[model samples]
Target: MKRSIALLALLLWLSTVALVHAQTLPSVKPEQVGLSSERLGRLVSMLRNDSEKGQIPGAILLVARQGKIALFESVGVLDPKSKAPMTKDAIFRIYSMSKPITSVAIMTLVEDGKIALGDPVAKYIPQVAEMQVGVEKPGADGKPTLELVAPRRPMSLQDLLRHTSGLTYGIFGNTLVKKQYLDAKLFVGDPTNAEFVDRLVKLPLASQPGTMWDYSHSTDVLGRIVEIVTNKSLYEFEKERILDPLGMKDTAFDVTDKAKQARIAEPFPNDVTIGTDTTFFDPRVPQRWQSGGGGMVGTVMDYARFCQMLLNGGTLDGKRILGPKTVAYMTADHLDGSVAPGPLYLPGVGFGFGLGFAVRREAGVANVQGSTGEFNWGGAGGTFFWVDPKEDLFVVYAMQSPKQRVYYRPVLKNMIYSAVVKPNGK
Candidate 1:
């Protein structure tokens, strides 16, 4: 009886050590990890349903927990035009999702003492120091024209990160400032970063520096700031500082290889969006305009690696990109209650704007089910990812249907959370 008891105890000790020594991001069954295999099947089924109905062209979904991959799926088509199969390694246009990367790049520079969040925009971009804000006024031709007013304060790097700067995306609305953006073609085609910034400064501010939140060209401006401080193009700096270090080999400002061009994802032929038509970039040919805000093409596995790094507190596979405190600072809410709400996107109710992400202030604010401290951002194209630090979880979805993106982000967020089952029923 004593010998039998000792053998059982030894077996228990071996099991404990196996759990403790788990690898980071190792592919595992959902049940073996902390997720529900049955429920994960349900999540993938929804993707199939959406694709079958022609709601979404195609997508890639990845979920990681406790540093292990629980789910990775490739569904739908690679090219809607050609009906090619969507592979796990197919490239996608991760539009606004690029902002998070640019934001990280800025904070990495801050970590190096090369820059600070509180620095004035004019300090680096001189044209912004004395820029005037625009107020619409009635004109002699029965049309409204912009009347210039001095800004209450100078725009800062922090404001740019939070989208509180008086900038506007021409695609969002028909405001006079947006018209100015349209007039100048601030982000049109192959203009170099310098030319883009020069053309951008010629426009008037959409709002006071810190008064309102407009989803404008602020991130592209932030990208330019990164270029200015590093003395390298935004693409080059990103490759050295973040992408290469993280082993995100397939992520880049442009895909120049002839072979990779065949893997590029394409949107539907007609404009099916409600407000405005999106401009799709052709990766086969390179353009000089590197939109740090929206110009990036990457694979599903590559972006999942990026998300895992952020979930691991700025380190992934032994790489330390940003320190823990810096990640905390970047994801923390910068827009307190004092500032009026900006664009209503994530955490629909109890959420705030962070340096680089939309943070969840409470669990029940949004239509979806998620824990507090849940920060996420999505692309105009149907690509979204969320990191829940409380649960050590992050999920990434990549697709290319701009019109259906609005429907998919919340839908996927809710489905992924519903799939979670407590370990040992704890």
Candidate 2:
């Protein structure tokens, strides 16, 4: 009788935990949210046709408008090899989508007066003060050589948030500085966040601070700073402050639970290369570094809550993660004409970098269809999300196809906007 009572207690506890993590958003028909059911069917057919053709293994998409989920869909298999049917709860490696989460954590510190945007990054991580900029100049043999020069100014916390800290991801470019990053083998052993930053400061910056907007490891540096400020692991601080309150129970740097392991999504075996000779990390393997830039795995529902929180001005289910004005400040464009975009500008045209998102500056300038205030970012692993304040809409597309991400992002954006027949419910 005692053993039965203990088992019953455990089951009750698990049920209560599930209730805590349950989605708070209401579900409605697409039409109720000003979305055309017929048009949405077309979107479903496209994904299903692609899955049937083996173009994609599978995917889960959640479209929410006016604080209600209009379309929550799953198509294709979770694992192409195992042929496990794709489910709404399937976990995906969110990659650089992790940046927005890390960025939000830093902003929470900002809200608490723990850190200032204009403060020099070296204030928190002193090693950054010693880093130099790498400039390519002609050598005696007339061949271009890297020249390390002092930065015109120190990199501020804002610079890191905006990707203007002059840091470059080694896998994307072929510059001398990037070659040095490759030579360093930064991820070979999965160093702790501190060790990662230590090796990074030893390398030269790609440009002078705040001069260029480059997709980079700037968020990773911000992650280390977060660790330093809170005296907690990046995951720990984020969990306590953001994830737990938002009930993002499934989003984490890694997945270790045996039961949840079965839900991990996988891409096609041949579709893994992200950049020049680089592949996505396996989230199953435990690592010390919680790469704030590109090392998180989560489900579509978990991310929807996060997006909803941002859309609702940093509050969800009565829990305020950030102030409304802070959300406005974060979503507004930070870039102007002066800051030149780097060659690998991930924000594309008609958009600018905000704190953690690519804020759209115009509705018609870019080939894609989105509102002027829409802010978004995608992951190297193929997950994508955007929150359009103008449309009262947010969408989360979760997939694992690295090579096909760029193509599908625009396609999905165009199709989603096309289906908005009522235009913010008229």
Best by TM-score: 2
Candidate 1 per-residue lDDT, tens place, 1-426, comes to: 999999999999997775433222478888766688888888789888888788778888999888778898988888888999888889888888899999999999999999988999999999998789999999999899889999988999999999888887777778787777776766566798888988888889888888876777899999999989999999899999899887677788788998888898877776335235456767777878788888888887777778888888899767799998989988888876557665543435777779879898887757778888888888877788888898888888898887888787777777777778774224
**TM-scores for every candidate against the unseen true structure:** 0.90, 0.95
What is the Cα root-mean-square deviation between model 1 and the actual structure? 7.4
Instruction: Give one digit per residue, the lDDT tens place, for model 2 in 1-426.
Output: 999999999999999976765555689998998998888888888998999899999999889999999999999999999999999999999999999999999999999999999999999988889999999999999989998899999999999999999888889889999899888888878899999999999999999888899889999999998999999999999999999998888999998887889999999999988888788677788899999999999989989999999999999988899999999999999998889998988899889999999999988889899999999999988999999999999999988999889999999998988889897857
Q: Which residues of candidate 2, in runs, are more than 4 Å off?
A: 1-24
Candidate 1 C-alpha error for residue 397, in Å: 0.3
On lDDT, the candidate that comes out on top is 2
The C-alpha RMSD of each candidate to the native structure, in angstroms, is 7.4, 3.1
